[model samples]
Structures are given as C-alpha cells and as structure tokens.
Target: MLRRSGLQALQALLELARHGQQWSSVSAIATAQELPAPMLEQLLLQLRRAELVESRRGRQGGYRLSRAPEAIPVAEVLDAVGAPLQLSEGPAEGSDGRAETQVLQSMGQRLQNAIERELKQLTLQELLFDLESWKEYLSNEGGLMLG
Candidate 1:
C-alpha cells in the first residue's frame, strides 16, 4: 500500500490529468482531491524535482504534468514522491548464517523486483481508467458495505 504522501501525489496527478495540459493551482487540486494543501505542495515540489511535473510562478501560474498521462508510470510517481516500492532489508539481527535465511532473503528480493516491473508497466492513464471504473461500480453498487 502507498503511504499518505504517495496516495496524495497520485490523486493530485490524476486531477491534473483530468484537466489535460491546463495548469492547476495547488489549492484547486487539494480541494478537489480532499488533500491537505500544505503537504500537497511539498509533494508537488518533490515531483517537480523528479521532473514528473512542471510548475510556473505568478498569479496565473501553477503545476501541470510534464508529460502525457500515458507517459508517466505509477512507479515513477511513487519514486518521485520518495515512496519507491521495496521490501524491508535483510533478516533480523542476531540470526545465524543459515541457508533458510538466505533463501528467504532471495525470495523477498525477487518479489520486490516483480512488483517493480509490474508498476513500471502501469501508467497514470491506466490508473485513471481503473479509478473511473471503480467509481462507477461503487455507485452502481450503492457504495461498499463493510462488515
């Protein structure tokens, strides 16, 4: 699962994509996505540094996607927000140098790699489509029911 910042960044990006190449103010995005403006601004700064989004100054200035939605991968967005998917480091301390430990470590690394590969193939455009589908489904279902 994504951290709060990563989720917020994705939401903000989706909002921008929905608007096409038009620049969107931080406040506008925050309000639309229900994210905190201050934190969203910081996340946008990180994204700008990563070159995932571009920003402009002045009264009519704000931020917009640096590339088309299809060109920006979900992995790239997570990376830009400093939330790269990764498994926790090696086994716990004080563990004996056992073959089982090594096997588990290798498996963990392989799993992480597979996750990264899938994420790389998933772009913002795809996610946006999925998001819309989910919204429609939920609405048709009269929202989700929790036990």
Candidate 2:
C-alpha cells in the first residue's frame, strides 16, 4: 500500500546514497526499489519541496538526498509527504457508545502522545546505520565487521 511509500522512498534514497549509488533519473530509484515510476515521481516532488532532496538538470541528472541523512528524521519525511497523523473521535453518542468512547478517547490521546514522543526521538542517522548494519549482517553473517 502507499501508506508507507513515502517513508520507504526516503529509506531507499538514503541506502543508495550510503552506497555511493549514482543514476540520472527517477528510473534508477524506481528500478532499484521496484517502485513504480509515477509513484516515485510523486514522492520525489514532495521531498524536493521539503528540501530533503535536490535534482540536477542534465543528462547526468537525478535526485539525491539534499542533506546528510543524519540531519533528517523519519518523522520529518512523513510530515513532508502527508498530513500529520491525528487521533479520531470515538463512537457516536448512544449510551454504549458514550461509555466506550470515553475510554477510547483517552487511549487515542495517549497513543498519539506516545507516537510523537518516539518519533521525535528517532534520528535518520540512527536509522541509516541500523539499515547498513542489517544489510551487512545478511550479506555476510560471519564476516561483517563494524568498527
């Protein structure tokens, strides 16, 4: 689903940049991630507007991360791509609904608070490092070494 496409795209771009990848078009990212061209294009536009990515305008032109991955956070990318996640009002005002709604309303607020707290704590640098470590581990279970 496109639900996580924006976040996924950001991760893909960060991974490619971390690997010294170079290509002249969105096709490169789309091909590498197996993402559709139109989808990648749409996300890329949002990224550009947020200044999270920049593109070159020539034969060797392609999109690239605009700043250090460490400087960006997953939450920021999500915000740039879509609306801020909000909690919903619970059930209608019948007796049972009111009873259930009261509890759900409190829980919803708590859930949103927790999510924002954690998201604020996460940094793109940490995410990228974790990703690199995972890929290395998978590719060389016994030989991948970190300094």
Candidate 3:
C-alpha cells in the first residue's frame, strides 16, 4: 500500500500540474489542497531530488514540473515520494507455513504488477483532465463545489 505521505505528495503534485507551466508556491498549493505547508515542503524537496520538479528562489520563487505533465508517469510520482509498489516479507518460517507464504507472495506479486501497470499508463495531465471533467459534471448536476 502507498503511504499516506505519498498520497499527500501526489496531491501536491497534481495541484502543481493544474497550473501548467506556471510556478506554484508551497503555501498556495498547501492552502488549495488543505495540506500542511511543512509536509508539502518536504514532498517538494523529495520530488525535486527525483528531478520531477524544479525549484526557484527569491520573491517570485516557486516550484514547477521539470517535465510536461503528460510525460511524467504516476509511478514516477509514487517513486519520488517513496511509495514502493512491492511488498515486504514477513518472518522466516518452517515448512508448516511454506504453502501459505507462497500463496500470499503470489497474491502480493500479482497486486503489485497490476498496480504498476496501471500507474505507468497514467499521467498527471490525463488525471487532471478527468478530475476537471468530473468536477464540472458534479457542479452542473448537483451544485457541488469541488475546488
């Protein structure tokens, strides 16, 4: 499972993607996403280190995606945020639990494979577009505020 922090980081990046080529400040992103500034700062730093985003300094300084949203895979964001798709092994066991371990391992591998495959196919641009469409639909249909 992806960590909560990873999900938060993904949300922050999605927020940045919504801005296109423009730079976005941590405060603005956090405020918009209802996330803590400190958490977003750390996530941005991690993403920068991963070369997913670049940071600027000074009064008008902020962060922007290093590459186009369409080029960045969702898996890359998860990787940048340290959300690994693999599973960890449990304690060593004797022959009694060998079959159970094998079964669990197979299931875990299948799950990870499916998740990675889907995530690799997803891009921030597509995700943002879908979200915008959904928000529009909801607002028109039910008068809900998604922003």
After superposition on all C-alphas, the RMSD of every candidate to the true structure, in Å, is 3.9, 3.6, 3.5
Candidates ranked by lDDT, best first?
1, 3, 2
In model 2, the Cα lDDT at residue 36 comes to 83
**TM-scores for all candidates?**
0.86, 0.76, 0.82
On TM-score, who's better, 1 or 2?
Answer: 1
Candidate 1 clash pair list: none
Best by TM-score: 1
**TM-score-based ranking:** 1, 3, 2
Off by over 4 Å in 1: 90-95, 140-147
Better of 2 and 3 by TM-score: 3
| lDDT score of residue 143 within candidate 1 | 57
Better of 2 and 3 by lDDT: 3
Runs with alpha carbons beyond 4 Å of true place in candidate 2: 19-24, 83-89, 92-100, 143-147
Provide the overall lDDT of each model, using Cα atoms, as 2-decimal numbers. 0.88, 0.70, 0.84
The true-versus-predicted C-alpha distance at residue 60 of model 1, in Å, is: 2.9
Model 1 clash count equals: 0
